[model samples]
Target: MTSSPAVTAPAERVRPLELFFDLVFVFTITQVAGVLTAAPTVDGLGRTVALLAIIWWMYGGYAWLTNALDLARPGPRLLLLTGMAAYFVMSLAVPRFFDEGPFGLILGLAYLAVVLVHTAGFIGTSGHRGISRLGPLNIVSALIVVAAGIVPPQARTWVLLGAVALEALSPVIAGIGGFAIGAGHFVERHGLALIILLGESIIAVGTVASELGDVLRVVVGSVLALVVSAGVWWVYFEREERDSERLLDAMPPQRRGRAALLSFGYAYLAMITGVTMAAVGMKKAVTYFTTPLHDFELWLLPLGLALYLAGLAAFHRALAPVWEWTRLVAAVAVLLCVPAGLLAGGWLMLLVAGLVLAGVVVVSRTPGLNET
Candidate 1:
């Protein structure tokens, strides 16, 4: 009997099943935002960072799985659905992950399921032997997550931090020697994930508007938030995304996996976290535009945008010769606006961020100035 093709074909598009998986993935993002919304402090932001880093690591794993496994086969298809269900369960526990309760336990259990299914799916597929190197390390991370639930609430963060540490080490420890990347599917998966994050930012705007009594302020706030989000969208989608894809496609197979690891897996985490922080800030601004902003609210908007631009800079740096100084300069400019934003309140801060990002987009379109 002939064996099924193990890896996705280069010309193959992302399957509908993968999009369905992404829907579940976005739910996790929403839950992480909920955690930040509930507690908009430094502690809250730290928790959001920890939870999101762990969550995003696994989500990236699934994206790699789809890139390397032919989902047209029934076995791989079923495993993908199982992974999706596991993520949905993880999302359910996300909001209360740091709270002292059963939620952390739920998160741990769901996380274990996620890792096991991912490892199994990768191993089950033919010609995916490289997973043998990464799978055990992933399970070790998952077990650490389970242990995080058992620890006291104050100690959970430290335990989870251990997990994050392990995940960061997995690539270095396990190495990226034999993994294969289907360039088209891999790039499209991350791009669609970014779209989901941008959608959440837009959703936050609408959500803030929905809760407010002031129509005029709501309209103004929502429009300003869209402008900032759109400018970020243009910064990624306009040229860098296509250019990165072309570069990855042209790269040697061995190099493509590491490039995907750096650009999509690691850098996208920053972009996702930045969007979540900015969206939380946008909701606060739209809901409370008439009042002076809290310190966290004032800082979140601009700092969030700065982190996002920095992520874009890192994304380009991973693939291209230049560091994309335009984005880095824009990031620094956004950081410098904090004092100005501090004086102007949240609405004005949002406006300034939108304008700054807009300038980046416009400069990117100029011929000689756009090179890096």
Candidate 2:
């Protein structure tokens, strides 16, 4: 009898290449947060989203590639390292791109080059079957990127926007086969990235509080921000991770591929969106407290909270059909507290943060919370 190829479990050990790739994402995250910080207006908000979407798509594509191929292989490892270097260049260009008129065009072109190199590497390493699967979409993406480069200055922005959309949709249209990378690795990497985002928020909050020179307020605000971050951590890592692993494992191979794509691949967009908004909100809160509440900052506070809560909701919904009442209540309470924070000033931000933590605690401890 012929022997079957060995099957690997979704919980198989993570490779070093995976970890190194994640380290590179740290720079991408930092660049994203910095861009938001530089220009925190409505127009800036749209640009930030486009930039982030492009970055996320690039990272997500490579992640899926590693999921299928053996990252320990020299070819894949080198490609990832090269992509990492390209991403760093893109990140460095972000600040200048946003600030200078001509620089934005240059940044856009640099970003396209990074995507092309990464995609080309994938195509080169991918064999006949893999190439056949990815070829058309890859061609389309490359064309879009090239087109973005040559577009008129007035139209360059929209061209780049369209390129982002094309890049984002490539995977779905490609229908590439799943590689079955360990769910644990996927979850852990994202968990670590989320921690980095929260860490950034804490750093931002601390900086703001210190500038105020009010010891009690700084201590309270810092503590509250920590609690908020903890709540976000608990909500994800506490039970959701295990449940998702179980669900993915129980699914048939074909269905599991789709599940992985939807869960790990797409859902992260919502999660990152929340983190970005929260970061902005926290910064505004600190500024509003130090000075008088500007109309814009007042709007930002609630809007940021809403985005964060919406992401939380998206995560739960994607994992399973069941919903926790405490999560619902917590989200609503956070929203309600937004106005109170505005009226009472910075203390209200702290108070809303407290409510968010309490809701997390309640949800985490709730009896008989059904697991998918």
Top candidate (TM-score): 1
Predicted candidate 1 versus true structure: per-residue lDDT over 1-372, tens digit per residue: 977644554334688899889988988998998888898888888888999899999999888778767776798889999999989999999878787889989999999999999988766453267778988999999999999988888888889989999998899998877666777788888888888888977987887786775776668878888888898889999988788889998999888888888999789888888888888887877766656676676777777888888998898888887777888889888865466555655577778888899889888888778555
Best by lDDT: 1
Sequence-dependent TM-score of model 2? 0.83
Q: How do the predictions measure up, each by TM-score? A: 0.95, 0.83
For model 1, give the RMSD to the true fold: 1.9
Clashing pairs in 1: none
Clash counts for all predictions: 0, 0
- lDDT of each prediction vs. the true structure? 0.83, 0.63
